[model samples]
Target: MHAEVGDTVVVHGRTVGTTDRRGTVVEARGSDGPYLVKFDDGHESLVFPGPDVSVEARA
Candidate 1:
């Protein structure tokens, strides 16, 4: 996956009863690697997301 700053990342819940989460890509690590995301909850994480994640461009 590829993303840049200002992009929105959506992480689908891993199991039932869990809610999906959305975050903004605050930092792009490399051409194809991990990314730093600031979640809606005010938490930040360096995520190496899998197929369950989707990126929405910032237009």
Candidate 2:
């Protein structure tokens, strides 16, 4: 999951009638590219499972 700024993030949701959402990495906060991300809906949060977060590439 090595992602870059502008790269989209996808995760599985927990319930039916709802799907995982996608967000873009807005800033690289760590040594690796996994970064602080912001969704299209204007929501922002840190990706979980630190190592699970990765760089997808530039948009």
Candidate 3:
């Protein structure tokens, strides 16, 4: 639930047709990383992680 800047956030898909979303951790806000996500749909969003989301540190 806690992540730093430059981390990678992946929205795990439960179904096969459900595509996974990937975004870079642009800024850290509150206890989690409020990610600046760029999707293939040509849109971006600032998201705060919920309990179901998974976060990976940038190497």
Q: TM-score, each model?
A: 0.92, 0.62, 0.70
- Per-candidate Cα lDDT values, in order, are 0.90, 0.64, 0.73
TM-score of 2: 0.62
Q: What is candidate 3's CA lDDT for residue 53?
A: 76
Worst 10 residues of 3 by lDDT: 32-41
lDDT of 2 by residue, 3-54 (tens): 5567777655657877666778787676564467787688998875343333
Ordered from best to worst TM-score, the candidate numbers read 1, 3, 2
**Tens digit of lDDT per residue, candidate 3, span 1-59?**
88787777787777788888777766766675576665445567887778657888888
* Over 4 Å off, model 2: 31-34, 49-59
Number of the candidate with higher lDDT, 2 or 3: 3
TM-score of 3: 0.70
Better model by TM-score: candidate 1 vs candidate 2: 1
